[model samples]
Target: MSTFGELFRVTTYGESHCKGVGCIIDGCPPGLPLTEDDVQPQLSRRRPGQSALTTPRDEKDRVTIMSGIEFGTTLGTPIGMTVPNQDQRPHDYSETDLYPRPSHADWTYLKKYGVKASSGGGRASARETIGRVAAGAVAEKYLKIVAGVEIVAFVSSVGKVELPYLEALEDGQPIGKDFSNFLDHLTREQVDADVTRCPDPATSERMKERIMQAKEANDSVGGSVTCIIRNCPIGLGEPCFDKFEATLAHAMLSIPATKGFEIGSGFGGTKIPGHLHNDAFYRKADGSLGTVTNHSGGIQGGITNGEHIYFRVAFKPPATISQAQQTVTYDGESGTLAARGRHDPCVVPRAVPIVEAMAALVVMDQFLIQQSRQASATLLAPLHTPHHVLQAKPQPTV
Candidate 1:
């Protein structure tokens, strides 16, 4: 269960305060022109200490490629990458050895494994996500080069602060200067311009203030990230259990502290009648098929529909807080605890890249699966040689 994907698989390892955190990515296409440069940006973005609002743990999180490539090109072998953990303070987490933190994996891990890593909640820490971010960056590069797919995720809401809900607008509707083009126009630069990573200027400032307020009060806050995937090929999903939305949900919810997952018009669509909720198909000027609306979030019947794939991930408040909390100990003895450690006052900003990474992993996996199916469809004859014909191999001269 630690690994992800059928093709383009990634298995992550290491813990919060371990010697390092990294992943081994298998099934990446060869000759894709990859290097540590292709994977580091996301790691840097997801690293702690990016701003005062985040944890003060200062880790450069520089990644080192260990194998499965040569001369800056992939060898189609498993690519191993590592990012050493720096600035670890294991002593800070000694208290967790006694009392399990609320809303965290401490107790569950202990119950399941009968033991847990004594430092920084071990693998349960958000620090474990570094591997996912790194692998996601590589997948994103592949998607960009081969499929022209593009993805961007931003902090859409922090506590009560939120950006404009642009998904509600009709096609070509505008909220601001050319806001109708947001699906294609929004860029990582615009989102990263602020600490909160919310593209809306006024809203970003408000989100920052909310984070600071939480920090000052010795509390934490929760928020959501909205991700948009554009230029995705149509028909990239399977029906029933492996629905596109279901896979996306699985990926998004796997992130640490994620409390909810929603695709376009998600919970909001419940208010609309069936007719309004349905995205009607139309022919585009290019004579390609499209939809007048995208309420299905660019997917219909579990398959992509050549429209932008958009979704939102909700992250719970960081469970570790400096505020005093009352809870039972490992022995079930009642106790009051004021936990101490480096933690984010708000996690949404940092989670932006993480959300994007997880999304990329899902999309990349789906792309590979779809490519295999499409390739098989191109066969002029049976994919395998017919048994009778194969059995008639020319008799070799003795």
Candidate 2:
């Protein structure tokens, strides 16, 4: 249950206040170069205490590679890794014994397990994501090498302060020219330029204040992250089920606090008529098929079509806030529970790396599946149909 993927599997371990947390990545291609340095940078980005908007847990999240590599290259076996929890504080969570924090996983976890972690949310904690982040880094490296894949995610909204262009851009609009251009050319450096990670200098400053306002009031705020995957290989999704976007949604929602996922036009596409929503195609300079509009978000019929794949993930305000709440204990006794622990006032900024990592894992897994299918198909003779007919526009199969 802790693992993900079919061919490119990853199994994560450890808990919120445990000895450490990490994952084992299986089915990685051999001879690909890998090292702790490649994995550490992303972990550092997801680590707490980096900025005022995030938690102050003070973990270095230093990763150590245990196996599946030799001389800095993956050995095509299961790659095991771990990150120590230096600042773990079980004592800080004593209040959980008397009361279940409202909107958190505390009560449901206890009900399901009979005995939960002695401290904190245990497996439900954001600390659990340490393993996910580490595994994602490995997948990212492999994806980059094999396909020049570029997966980048950034904070697009914080509470009510949406990115300037995105404010009027959603809900049946043409996804303005500015946002389209930004998605094609934006880099991580531009995203990291501010702690909020909103990219626009002025907008990012506003997001900072929004988070500070929540922190000052001992409350929490929610936001969304927009991720784009460029140079994605064609034909990576499965039909009927297991669509590429479906897997992406599954992966993103698996992260702590994620509540919503949307791809391409998402809900915004609902209002438009079929004529405007459809992506018209044409011949590219490379003599391949291309879409004039990207309303499809680089996918059609549940498969990739070679354009950029983009989506947004929304996270609810963290449940473990410093503010007091009226709630009942596990015994149904009433109490006023005020949680005590370091938590992000706004998790959107730190979530940037996590989103990117999960996207990489999805792409890495889907790519491997598609690659194997292609290899299997190559062994047989070509179909009797002419090659030109196969390349022609959509044919009537129904």
Error of 1 at 88 (Å): 0.5
lDDT of 1 by residue, 83-176 (tens): 9998999988887878988888889999899999997878888888988999999999999998888899999889978776644342323223
lDDT of 2 by residue, 1-398 (tens): 79989999989999989999999999988998999999999999999999888898999999999999999999998899999889988999998888888887888888887878878888888888888888888888877877888988999898989886555546566665677788899999889888888888888888899999999998899999999999898888998689999899889999999999988877777766789888889999867788877878888989999888999999999888887789887788888988889899888899999999899899999998988877787799955667667555431111
* lDDT of model 2 at position 352: 92
Model 1 has a clash total of 0
TM-score of 1: 0.92
Sliding window of 10 residues with minimal summed lDDT for model 2:
389-398
Instruction: State each model's C-alpha RMSD to the native.
Output: 7.2, 2.9
Model 1 gets an lDDT of: 0.86
Worst 10 residues of 1 by lDDT: 389-398
Q: How far is candidate 2 from the true structure (C-alpha RMSD, Å)?
A: 2.9
Pairs with steric clashes in candidate 1: none
Cand. 2 TM to true fold: 0.96
**Every model's TM-score:** 0.92, 0.96
